[model samples]
Target: MGTDVDIALLVKELCHHDAETEWIEFKTNNSDAEMIGQRISALANSACRLGIPTAYMVWGVDDKTHDVIGSSFRYRLEKRGNEELENWLHHQLTDNASFEFAEDVVCEKHVTVLMVQAAFCHTVDFERVPYIRVGSYTKKLREYPVIESEVWSRITKSDFESIAAKGGLTLPDALSLLDFPKYFDLLGAPMPQSRDEVAHYLCDDEIILRQDDGRYAVTNLGAILLAKNLKDFPTVARKALRLVQYKGRGRSEILRSKDYEGGYAVEFESAVEMIMALTPSKEDIIGAVRVQTTAYPERAIREILANALIHQDLTVTGSGPVVEVFSDRVDFTNPGTSLVDLMRLVDNPPRSRNQKLASLMRRFRFCEELGTGWDRIISSCEALYLPAPKAVEYEGAGGSVRISLLAYVPYRSMSLRDRVMACYWHACICFTNGETMTNKSLRCRFGEGGPSSSTVSKLLATAVGDGLIKPVDPETAPRYMRYVPAWA
Candidate 1:
């Protein structure tokens, strides 16, 4: 429906309220920008206290009789000194609360409505002072310390996804800004015939919130996953995934780099494809023809990239997930330390800082549904006889986790640490699949050109000596012995 029709319905609903509310004010030709600013703060704070998502001030309505009389107010044309009224109010508000004005004809009279989102994360302040509504009167928030504290407490507990990325959008504006068709396609649902049904679905999925003023607000979840251009949402524009290709194994010489501008889901496949394309590959003769082989398995790369995006801390500002491709390794780093122990990721249940983002990515089949992502990466490495990937966590404020996929290294040239890690990861993968690592299995992972049986045994002994893996049965024959992860 058009904005005009929606505005008319909203006006009717507001008129039906039995009494004037703390969250709503009726005025006629009250064009004072300073007074409007105070009401905005008071109404926004009151809405939070009452657990309401939005508050409003409507003009062209009779204050006592609730009648829609024609208004002479022209908010769009109002100016304070040299600045527009809208811009001035925005600069004066402390909470960054999104408030917008919309004008339409209601009851055959011109009516203007100002919609204000409730205080979230901070109390709304105008001109350096906070305000709140008390029995329909606007008063300084400091005069009511108890109410101010309650607002702060409630605001801090809000979910990150509920925060507005962009506000005051009409249905058409929202549809144009987000890739709505792709959203339904990912969910495996047929498109609804009516536009209203589409809007309802988006709101139900928490992608967009329907406002009291008949406008729409894009949630962080919606913008992160479906925005056509992330730049439209300034709060999350910098959260776009980054990919860098280096000339060698260091950050000094960057070969190529890109910052994906679209939402994660929209740009995911293309990003993976680009990463694999930049990956080093060689030609190998298989039976009669030469086949191309990549330094890392494409399956492993996909899982790693998806995990980095899904598990990242969305609250972290200024940084996002990054994939760096060196000549010898690919490192996937994201802005959050691992919730699962680095050593036990193969067996631990999946934990994510952004659960909603993870769930949606899984629904779209971009990542694993079970906690087998790490297991698959390990197994793929074993299949190709490549060295096992390493996962490390950096702890502290602004800490992050990085997982590196290394190129194949000759067994004779591998370091002791590399050999021990290979054994531990093999045991981990085996234990996850209800099996244990044996000498023969370990040798198979090293391929046919690998070391002798005795050499493999020595490596296993070294791994055991380093407390990386333990024998399942110490009493078992040397040739028949099986090893499992030490923590198993």
Candidate 2:
């Protein structure tokens, strides 16, 4: 049954108890929405403090009187747009939990139940940041750095697979629908002749688990990689690949669309292939003839696709992954926000929420090991003179993560500042034995009308004066001008 259904049944139990215990409580008389949200947050926070899977807030019992008054406040009025209420509580509670809300009746009296599931292992960012409730007041999470530290510490130490999802299907049920032959083909391996052997092989791969019912269940790990269709799992179906096309600059034009819906590990190759098909080609001279080539390199496509597949939040429902294709640029946005700070994305090691998903995809050769994805993505773009794909993270409401590549040559937009930046970097790429930059080489690096004989010397003098670059050569004979990584 869905969390929605379990919550309804759970509410009935709380109402029947009619007593406020340490963990069980009722709000009979008060119907204020803010009051509703606050108490729910309290109960949820209290539930976390007690290590219980769930906590209840029911109507029909008094708060101060501790007597059964049975709530008369309109709960029907509560569900109208109270998603905002739940959402408010959500921001205050810092966990990625399935926690749901429902209404039920006992003794023919109206009662509302907020069934808050356990706090998820990792820190859950709400409104793009974490929050905490103190007594009844909501406060920024960073205010209580202890709780923040505790939560963050717990998150990094937690394993992806071992996180709790009670009543979440066991591994067997999840794997039953998988197509093993497809997996074998992708791996370039022979299909096992016997069912027992096939199942055993999958278990060894951690793709399937045998449940107590003597049936096999697929782990989310297995299903995401091998399911014939991801849609079967309503919670995490078809959140892959949204492509948006534009006619002009900055997502202005409306051109085309697509959403890839299949096991990502199984279908990532197909997704990347479609993206390649979508990218436009440019003709380049080859001796006396000309050949067409894609504006962005194939390695860029592979890296972005790998980034989308590996970093998505599987727990988020309804919203799936998306890739937006513009006439001049391609914007790849995933539903979950980034874990690391934006500055560190291109430098820090690779981290992921879905360990099993990332692991299986690696074995399938979708990408190389961690920490290298950024290196590959960045180097490929810089190598081709395409501005490196930019990593953008949006943290608000539902939050979003995006990688934007300026696909079109930004001839007009390449202002003087940009040209200078590009020149400096290009020169840097060629110096220090192919590892640094120099003022003289910067002009040659862009398009080969080597800087004027005197221009190179003047530019070098200015660079040294500005502390932007240092000249290693003192002797000016042969107009010597070599440079290395200044930061190095």
Candidate with the greatest TM-score versus the true structure: 1
Candidate RMSDs in Å, in order, are 5.2, 8.4
How well is each residue in 1-488 modelled by candidate 2, as lDDT tens digits?
12323333444434454345434556765666655544444444444444443455666656545444556765545542546555555555554544554555555666655554434554444434544455435555577877666555555554434322222233333334677787787778899887787888887776665532233445556656676666564334556456666676656656777665567766777777777778788788999899878878778788777877778876565676777776667777877888786544444667887777677777778876566676566556665556545677887646888887765344344544444434444444454234555554554443333346465555555555655455566574545566543443
Q: lDDT of each structure?
A: 0.85, 0.58
Instruction: Report the lDDT of model 2 for residue 244.
Output: 62
lDDT for model 2, please: 0.58
| Model 2: residues with Cα > 4 Å off, grouped in runs | 1-119, 122-176, 250-253, 283-290, 313-320, 335-354, 398-400, 408-413, 420-434, 448-487
Give the poorly placed runs of model 1, Cα more than 4 Å off: 1-157
Model 2 — which ten-residue stretch has the worst lDDT?
A: 162-171
User: Per-prediction TM-score, please?
Assistant: 0.78, 0.60
Question: For residues 69-177, could you state the per-residue lDDT of candidate 1 as single tens digits?
Answer: 9799988899999999999999999745567788899989999888787776577899988899887788999999898887787777765666667665678877788
> Model 1 residue 206 lDDT?
82
lDDT of 1 at 210: 84
